[model samples]
Target: MRRYVFGRLGQVILTLLIYVTLVYFLLQAMPGDITMMYLSNPKIPQAAREELKKQLGLDQSLFMQYVSYMKNFFRGELGVSFSQYPKPVWDILMEKLPRTFVLFLTANVFSFYVGFVMGKVIAWRRGKVIDYAATVVGITFWTAFYPLLALVVIWIFAYNLKWLPLNQFIDPRLWSAAPFTANQVFGNMVYGAAIIGIGIFFIFYYLLRGLKPSRRSRAQAWALACALIAAVLFVAARKGMLIYIWDITRHMILPVFTLTLINFAGTMLLMRDSMLETVQEDYVMAARAKGLPDKVVRDRYAARTALLPTVTSLVLSLASSMSGGMVTETMFSWPGLGQTLFAAALSNDYPLATGALAFTGIFLLIAHFIADILYAVLDPRITYTGQSGV
Candidate 1:
């Protein structure tokens, strides 16, 4: 295990170096620097442009600039944003990353749950009307143009029905009168989520560790878990954080809903195909022959094996939460890492854009490492030696 981990960690470092180099050089290769925006302005003299270029190190050899950037980046410096001048790229990323994480993470979780459940049922009832209907719906949404779908959903829910917020992360009317910044509220939300997650982890760990519980016992266990979550939420309400959270949730509904619609289809299809193959396995037949209930045979036997691929996909997607959704963020006027990267690239803010991409690349590489380790744990058939996994 140690040898395998070390090998993977080494590969991650090398890959990250390549990724950062490519991002920096590619951004430098763009048509013009940030100074291009001032070129047509007659009042900004040529000397001023030269001075600005020198200040930003745009005058240096590309190789030297890359070396300098890599050095600074290794030392935890991501440089300053050229568009939003004097603000560190790290600060901008920190400010926006949580919002992106929350949005995509929520969407991915909802999509995974809904897709997995639907896929399991449809696979079991493959020849039924319900299966065909689900397949048609999933495929239709999965193939639909994402931007158009998002716009239509917004028009129906936000603009016409008046069920949700039109756009932006929060209601300006509500936040403008608040004492604290939105970031503070976001930080509190993170803390509350962490606490609740840890609590749930313990609850499941203890309650489901040994043998199966009776139906009443199982219901009580779930109730206890729900109460634990509600307690955390209650504390947030007492601390006056709930109102802002609700506002953000209201704004989030349309995008999250739209994303879940578009994404769940792929997961569902993947799970369905995997389950179809898994159901014919010898172990599944054995389980059925032992007089086990169909539900238990399907879930405990077929579904668990079929879940491997879905779980891997979900983990990688979760890692990509840092990258954010460019169209989703932009259409909704949600200021996040995605929108930040989009604006930076358009404005030729090389530092900010490269930083954003590099940050995302790092997360993706780490997620790959985590997924590889998870494969061994999830399947006894797979083994990792000092060499490649088998």
Candidate 2:
């Protein structure tokens, strides 16, 4: 296991190195100088532009610039953004990353848990009315009109109805003022706590319900505990003991639903097919012949084998997710890395663009590495053995 992990980690490092090198050169090859973009304003003199170029090391040969950039990258310097004034590319990413993390992590977790449970139920009840209905609902909800649905909900609830706030992270009023009083801080915490607790319960109920019998009981208990906490917080929030959870949900909900819906059909289909295939396998037939309960056979013999392909699919999906859904983020104005990358590309911000590319590559490499490890874990017959194609 150690050997397999180390080997995959090595490959991940190599992949990232190669990708970063390629992106640096590709960005360098693009027309129009970083300095030229700034100097085009005509306020800066020729000598000042030359000095800036020299300072930025853009005056050097392409090879030298690449070498320097690599050296700096190794030292954890991602270089400065040409488009943004007096800010490093890394700094901009860092500032935006927490928001993206909060949004994407929440959305991914919600989708995976909910989708997995729905898939499991459909798999177990294959060919039944319930299964068919779920299939139709899942496909329709996730694939066809999920984004439109979210839009309509937002329009009705937020814009027309005035029940929720529209677009923006947190309430501006809460953030605009200087140091908050203890009461304000406590109020904010109460509201935030309630919102998160309630959101998690709604999103993860299916996941808890789908766990193995031995695990599901414990998960239910935990869910109950969370419900109690959420209830308490909700009461506090109502009494002004807590501030209203800032209505970031408007900006957050669409992207979350879009991602979930985009991935739902494929996940469900994959699960259905995998389960069917597993049920038909000789081992499953043998288990059934041994007079094992249908549930036991399904869970122990079938689901285990079915998960291998699902893990592989999940790994591949990570690349698309981490690339940052440009169209989705742009349409919703989510202010995620996807939008940032798109903006950089349009403005020809080489440093920011290259940084974004590098980040995407790193995410891909990590996702692939994780998938490789999971593959080994899911199937004992498959061995890494320090060689390719386990």
Candidate 3:
């Protein structure tokens, strides 16, 4: 396990190193430097422009500048933003990271569980009316008009009806005061925790319940119920339940739904194919021929083996979450890294742009590495033979 983890980690570091180098050269190849954007505004004089360029190190050799940038990046110094004077690039990213994380993580969990279960159900009833209907609906919703559907919903509910806030993070009113009191911070944390707990419980409870031993296993049922209740109460104590529910539900609904819809078709189809194939495998046939219960054969032989492919795909889906749906974030006005990166690109803030790119590259590389590790764990038939696993 230690070797596997270290190998993957090494690969991630190397990938990031290559990505950073490529990004630096690519930025260098762009038409103009950050100063040009500011200079074109006509407000600042040429003298001021020259001074600003000097201050920002645009006057230095390209090699020297690149070296300096890399050094600072390694030290977690993302350099100053050309647009936002005196603000470090790292600081901006930190401010936006949490919103993106919450949105993406929620979407991933929803999509994976929903797709996984739906795929199993369809596989169990393959070639039937229900299976065909589900396939059609899933394909249409996921492929034909996922983005448009989300936009329409947001427009109708948030714009036309004015029922939801169109864009932005939490209500500004919540943090307008200077030097927030300890009570306020504590209250906010507690409220946030409670909402997250409640949302998770509601979403995953059915899936967990369905996995219970038997319909008459009241003890197992009660245990799950208690677990759910305890989680909700614990979250409520840390963050008031009312605030938690309001924010999580309001802000999360559209994004989560959109992400789940986008991923549903692919996941469902993959699961269906894998399960169907597994059901025909010689081992599965053997298990069925031995007079085992149908449920036991399906679950133990079919479902277990089918899950290998799904597990790989699921890992990739989870990694893709960090990209955080650019269009969706724009539509919802959710404050996240996607929007921040968009702004950086539009403004030609080289340091900020490259910093965001580096961050994204690092995140993707790490996620891929994790997926590779999971693949090895799930299938002992596969083996890695590299100083750094890929």
| Maximum-TM-score candidate | 1
Tens-digit lDDT string for candidate 1 (25-133): 8888899889999999999999999999999998999889888999999898999999999999999999998887678777888888888989998998888999999
lDDT of 1 at 54: 99
The TM-score, computed over Cα atoms with residue i paired to residue i, of candidate 3 is 0.81
Model 2 per-residue lDDT tens digits across residues 223-248: 77677777766765665544433345
What's the CA error at residue 299 for candidate 1, in Å? 1.3
TM-score of each: 0.92, 0.75, 0.81
Candidates 1 and 2 compared by lDDT, better number: 1
Candidate 1: lDDT of 72? 96
Best model per lDDT = 1
lDDT accuracy of residue 22 in candidate 3: 91
Clashing pairs in 1: none
- Candidate 1: segments with Cα more than 4 A from true spot: 205-221, 316-324, 383-390
Ranking by lDDT: 1, 3, 2
